[model samples]
Target: MGKHRAYKFRLYPNKEQEMLINKTIGSSRFVFNYFLSLWKEEYKKTGKGLTYNKCATMIPALKKSNEYSWLKEVDSIALQSSVKNLEDSFNRFFKKQNKAPRFKSKKNPNQSYTTKNVSNSIQIQGNRIKLPKLKMAKFANSRDINGSILRATISRKASGKYFVSLLVEEHIQELDKSNNSVGIDLGIKDFAILDDGTVYNNNRYTTKMAKQLAREQRKLSRRYEQAKKDGKKLEDAKNYQKQKIKVARLHEKVANQREDFLNKVSTIIVKNHDVICIEDLNTKGMLRNHNLAKSISDVSWSMFVDKLQYKADWYGKQIVKIDRWYPSSQICSSCGVNSGKKTLDIRNWTCECGVEHDRDINASKNIKNEGLRQIQSYDKIG
Candidate 1:
């Protein structure tokens, strides 16, 4: 069972060291985009695709001749890994069997680089990490990465904090048949309502930190105004950076809380259940409606689903996604009657056959029944 996993470590750095980390990230991104453009141009002109090795070989020569000669300060192997990753991305996008490759934009310019030989003595101490380039820096191990490291990503979030992610390979053992099975209906108000009548209340992770975030943001905005008034817009004021880090730390705290909660919930579910059934939600499309947008984003149903999926796969449990069009919530679980006209405001209702139901619980039950039916059908066919 070849599986992929990653372990994360929290990095702590002095101001100077932090700057170095930022520079490394920027240089890596530059190297990737630069090589990507060069390869793309060559392919357009000569009608020949560049392999990863060929693309990587061109980097040293280009860096010596370009404005980014500073990239030489970092590990050359890390830079090569970035080019190789770009090549992989292009291969996926331009495969004859796949759709056409699309253009890259600055707003979405690919970020992060990788390094092989990741399995060689990578450990977390109190507040530092031992990387190939930086030797030993300040970082703390956040989670146990269950797999061997394959790559690492360095990127900044919207809150302007730098983070490094380790990608790894994890293999899991098969699950036994006697484990539990469950169906879950996700909701903004309830978080998750299981078929077993268990209701996990929404913690509203973002909302809980809204006050502190707004306060820091206010400080940042005031610093920005002062900087503009001083006519030094190119360089943000010292106060601006102070406020920025404050805001980033707050956002990081919120994210940490959310991740912790999700991990606990996912771990519990995975441990108890052999098969998990969930709705195939169109979260992106659903986010378009402004009315429930805040609540929806706060819950992060998409992230929840993704965590459930890979974890389920790792645990050798089945995660079945009912079709997006499937009317799980609209159908009465007792008699299979369609509650087609049900609205979001309808929390509880009685079926035509006189069965009382809590809307989410009923939906979860219907989902479980349908999932079982499908599994049985598949088994019969097999």
Candidate 2:
């Protein structure tokens, strides 16, 4: 069996191509919203629901009957995919895996429809990528993709940056073999403290750009307020849309920067270690802490761990997630004594056993030992 893979490209489409992409995105949103509304109405009236396959089958007839000839402009497969996404969302909601369905807004929907397993190759000559509908565009890098392109989505961010995300399918290559293993402890001070005594400081991308972002946001807010007063707010207003794009571009820049950093860190750790251990953090609970809220969100610790886990799998390395309730930080790595009362501000402490411990580093060591013990126990059981 092959692995499903995905890659993203930062597209730099020309003006003409940009317009086409914008139109495609708008059309896709229309179709999705139209069907979603229709489905909701049917559910209320008939007490029955439409399946994605049903929706896909009905689209051509619906368009012909309704005189929505513009629907013909977008690829049929793309339309089917969009319907399938709705189906999957509903399935997940019914399964209690996700929240109830919500309406998509036109202001920031930033996505459109495209198909999978077709002639959807975006060429890369040097640093440029060729986008369908959109012409040749430049990118910062050409990812080593290993799958057929499924969807090509062009999006404009709050910072006015444009990007294309590609979903693909390919077999995953096995990772190299090694006996080395390492443990990771994630904390507020450092993003991760490894068992090998390395501390990767948390580079809070959003926090670092806070001041500049705030300035841009304030500008956007002022524009919005003025528009509200003058009744000048219309979706198609050129200046209003331009400001929205600016705000979106900033948010996008921060996200891109964070993703890049996480990818590099994950790649390095997976390549260097044969086994990795990390805590299963309760990110939702962590978000509730008022004092550390912004810092925690800016750290994107959960996303970092997610990247690490997936990259480890792709590289044939093992990743063990220690239970969140485990007192990795409170237990002494050397003496096995519980110091659960240690305050959060206490960065370092000397144990009664004369072991000097940096809180995070010590926690990392403890976590590593626990992971090793679990592995050994599993081996014994087998």
lDDT for model 1, please: 0.77
Kindly give the stretch of ten consecutive residues in candidate 1 with the minimal lDDT sum: 102-111
Error of 2 at 360 (Å): 0.9
lDDT of 2 by residue, 1-382 (tens): 6665667667676777767666676666777778888889889999877888778888888668657877766556566777888888889988999986766666663655565545644555677766654446777666677666656656765455577777666788877777788889887778878988998888888888899889987887887877777787456466667777777777877988888888888888999888898888999898998998988888788898888887776778998889988898889999999967788888889888999898888889988899988999999999
Candidate 1 error regions (>4 Å): 13-20, 43-50, 63-68, 92-112, 118-128, 142-147, 154-164, 170-178, 234-236
lDDT of 2 at 152: 66
TM-scores, in order shown?
A: 0.86, 0.89
TM-score between model 1 and native: 0.86
What's model 2's lDDT at 229?
75
Q: List the residue pairs that clash in candidate 1.
A: 3-170, 5-168, 127-138, 127-139, 128-137, 128-138, 128-139
Residue 280 CA displacement from its true place in model 1, Å: 0.4
